[model samples]
Target: MIHAYRFYIDGEWVEPCVPKTLEVIDPSTEQPAGTIALGSAADVERAVTAARRAFAFFSRTSKAERIDLLKRIVAILKRRNDELGDIISREMGAPLAMARAEQAGIGATHFEQTIKALETFAFDYMQGSTRILREPIGTIGMITPWNWPINQIACKVAPALATGCTMVLKPSEIAPFNAVIFAEIMDEAGVPKGVFNLVQGDGLTVGVELAGHPDVDMVSFTGSTRAGIAVAQAAAPTVKRVHQELGGKSPNIILRSADFSAAVTAGVRRCFGNSGQTCTAPTRMLVPVERMEQASSIAASEAAVLVVGPPSDPRTDLGPVASSAQFDKIQTLIERGIAEGAELIAGGLGRPPHLDAGYYVRPTVFARVTNQMTIAREEIFGPVLSIIGYQSEDEAIAIANDTPYGLAAYIQGDPEEARALAGRLRAGSVRLNSAAWDSAAPFGGYKQSGNGREYGKFGLHEFTEVKGIVGFLND
Candidate 1:
């Protein structure tokens, strides 16, 4: 078993002020995979102090210097890519193939993209007679979720480094091995001492302390909506900037012009991808009422083919959810879907056949679901899909936008009509005809989904504060 009992602070691996530890479980086997030291407020303070001290020089670093640092980090990450994939699979139940292709790959992608963005990004620009400057915000406190662990970490960390900002990261304790490995990568890449720090702990202690720390200029959080509100509240006293990418119950609208078979199949695959734990998953499928039966059949057929097994299995497409708590939550929601009168069209309640142990949940689908139903309204972080029929195109848009979340929306139909309909979506990211996700595009949400954005130029800008210098140049 792997043992990670030290926190990364000030360029060294040091024991926490308090020696509390948490067992890291492999969700697939329900076995203890590893252990990590649980951090305390004192640990958070140490990390914040280190970041504050580093900001003095790091913030003033030239773009070229920061670029080199990012490049080096990317190189080290590439060398350890496969190792990262295996570690993440064991920690969070992501299939090994997915862990390598997306989990680990996205981390490297962020660093590489940020480096290219920095090459042409203008930090200082002129407007009228005044010069506008975008400077790095100091001492960021980042709290990332267990789902998409490395992806969230890299998106935040890569941009912070690119923008020449110092940060203290508190990766989710449930899935922290990848973060620990990443910190080692930073050390190997020769990141300036104290420029980056890691504290492993739960949100109540370390996360709260990091957000409420007076020295932290900003707090970037990616997790559930409830925790995000708490982070915002804690950081409010210090008036630090809070950037959140919270929960999403995104909608997928299949227009009357679309091919139902293809759309429904693709939607099921996308929804179940990551065991349906993605914050922006298209969980609620809005189909034409006239074709409800047809859509349901396709969705059921598509879900039937998914291979649910241990993450280590080469053929497994769906692994167990991240933890016992998550598994329980998904199971409860699936039961609620049934009790609430939604028709069970596919797999339902309990583990897949032959899976006696582990946190596995059956990939479930509910048909004839209404917007008011619990299954359709709430975010079920599992392989569950709720298909709701809509009377008209206008009704579909209304139903899609009814939720508190506006993280993402999907549309399938003729290109022209889909594009036109996509304009009506309240979501931040709208995918048409199952288009490929663009890493360069700004990603976040509208309304309760959370504020601010990440990825590419938008991500780099999130770590910076704008300053307008009036009359600095002679006119």
Candidate 2:
């Protein structure tokens, strides 16, 4: 009944050039929630032109003006936080609590962070006889995924706006209601006409068009490595700047000295947050060989306590996977885990017991999982855990870095030991002793987990290009 079957471009809601549409299904009910107009190459072109026109003057706006704009955006977003959470839960199947606490909350936080960073950030720095100026990169093309809909979109948009860069957004067609609401916030916040635009469609159509558009100066993408590669390739011929946050097969190392019960149980629970669909989930857990049994038992017991049910249910901790395709993909991976001879310590394929309808999946844990196993190497993007055993601390680190991903790594041990292990890991961010997040820290990956960083001043810098003004004083 919610109608979002159009694109928001040039500060107005416009129909797509092509009338292709896709039905969005609520994963909790397995019913059509709404339909979004699918955008095409022409639609992307229209958006790019709009953003390009807006960038000429908007990018030249003074820092103070941009700061005020960001603040206004933050205020508008906060006012509609509850409505945003509701749409996210219905469209993406996140529990209402998580939608409120993390999904919508992180979006507002990112905006606030951008505003704060802009206040102290130096756009022009004196360098001896010359000055180095950090200028806005021209129109950006942002392609965000479904798992953390607003989190990714806001992270990109807030920084782009703070840096005085205009942009066109292509949120995942699977869970796009949050984005629709976000477009409304931008409009309400008095963003200049054409400074922000939205085009909804699958990756093949709108995604490819946006990445390949010559007018688009940069493409900031968050999705699977496979898709990231495609976006990079598409933009390669144009030689545009490509920033990616790709797939992650993160490792959670539970040292023998750490409290096994507490660490294992807590780790499993956190990994399953967001239905275990997070890109940086601790899907690969490495434990000492002797402690494998204990870790597995604790993880399985903890997973049992997770309530997988409707997103609207206040008691449900884990909601349904975002879509039917995701549901099928998860089941196939779980079956692959069983076929590869890994012990299904707790759950297997299909929905959790007592949940007959919905695209729900059982919270599964697999033990004795080798690094070479299908589930261990692949990004499952489901509420599934794989426990791999190692003999020594060095061996554990090796197994942890064995994957193609290096997004995030977890270490549990004495503070000193954890810090030491964290340094050795090939990941961008390491959570030592289960530390809380630092908003100002740089976040990115080393290898295939994708390039470039987000959060704090690092994210603001990503949206800008630096130029040296040599000998202008002589003029």
Candidate 3:
């Protein structure tokens, strides 16, 4: 069903209001992967109406039922895992291995995490002779980004379902087929009709309509800060709750107490992972002024070894940015880094010499960068790292918290001291000594990175409305 160019609305594959389609480009080859039926305002209205109609019954479901439903979803995801990975690789240009394991695999992880959260969650309890209820916030409008496409979709979709909230999803048009397959999975998992809907279109049409619609109770968006702001403004008139996880230029602080080689290597590796498309990537690395040269050398070495090839290459460590627009933006930033006098220790302009075509970017390292530099300030969503020098711990902390984005930050130092320093940083998530990612932990931003958390139990809460029955509940 998903193979066709159709929207999954009201639990059926339906044709668009007007038969318009958009081509999905595979960045690795700059070739057409496929096309999706582009939706309009009318489609958003149809999807939202369906979601609103279903919310009443779905919200009343027991937690156990939702847990079972999430379990089924997880099982189907795992069964079709590699298949979905192939789709992601084709559309987004992630190396097949990373695409399979991290990209497609993360979807199952989100569902498993949602099931765990749903199992232990307390939907209602009595306090002071009053019953406090956490009810579903009906009809959610979710707009997700192309980078880490499934990660955004599952994190939002799983939680909304776990909380019994119906939703209309506007996945990034750049890599939309994964969402089509995802909707198919929901159908196979026996998810009720109208409980979840998928609309294929750009942000201007489907996204804006969903956000501004009177029936949609909340808007959840994951994308650039500029786009996130637009979603908020559009949702304002309806007074719908808006949850956004926007852009980030997350800092990775390599403290004086740590091993310079080890810290710098790890920072570069993390930054370059996913071809540096991660929003929470350590784009800016802050090191002591004395160790700048060492950090620069280590970072350059890491960048040198990274294989920037076609996503089809098994040995490829980094793949192309999602589109030509992304390639141009990253190229401009690399040029700016050189022009601004930041020492370009590794990678400058253009694609790798070996690769004749494709949007592959040279893994770049810019040293002697100051916080004021555009390379340091901007969220260049590519495998580019900027090494900024800091004189003292206070300066490092200051520099780390200086960005408008507070999505995540990293500290490579003693666990205890990093813990202390982590608190001082204004980011929502701070990893210590390259700590592992915790799915249960609350994940969101402190400021303009956007509002609300979306992970485990924290994510489930975001889809709920709190109500108190004071007089009716007499204990």
Write down the lDDT of every candidate, Cα atoms only.
Answer: 0.93, 0.92, 0.91
TM-scores, all models, native as reference: 0.99, 0.98, 0.98
**Considering lDDT, where higher is better, how would the candidates rank from best to worst?**
1, 2, 3
Off by over 4 Å in 3: 1-3, 472-475
The top-ranked prediction according to TM-score is 1
**TM-score result, candidate 3:** 0.98
The per-prediction tally of clashing pairs is 0, 0, 0
lDDT of 3 by residue, 188-227 (tens): 9999999999999999888899889999999999999999
User: Candidate 3, residue 426: CA error in Å?
Assistant: 0.4
For candidate 2, the lDDT comes to: 0.92
Question: Can you write out model 1's per-residue Cα lDDT over 1-475, one digit (the tens) per residue?
Answer: 9899999999999999998999999999899998999999999999999999999999999999999999999999999999999999999999999999899989999888888888999999999889999999999999999899989999999999999899999999889999999999999999999999999999999999999999999999999998999999999999999999999998999988988799999999999999999998999999989899999999888888899999999999999999999998899999999999999999999999889998888789899999999988788999999999999899999999999999999999999999999999999999999999888888999988899999999999999999999997876
- Top lDDT hit: 1
Give all candidate RMSDs, comma-separated: 0.8, 1.1, 1.3
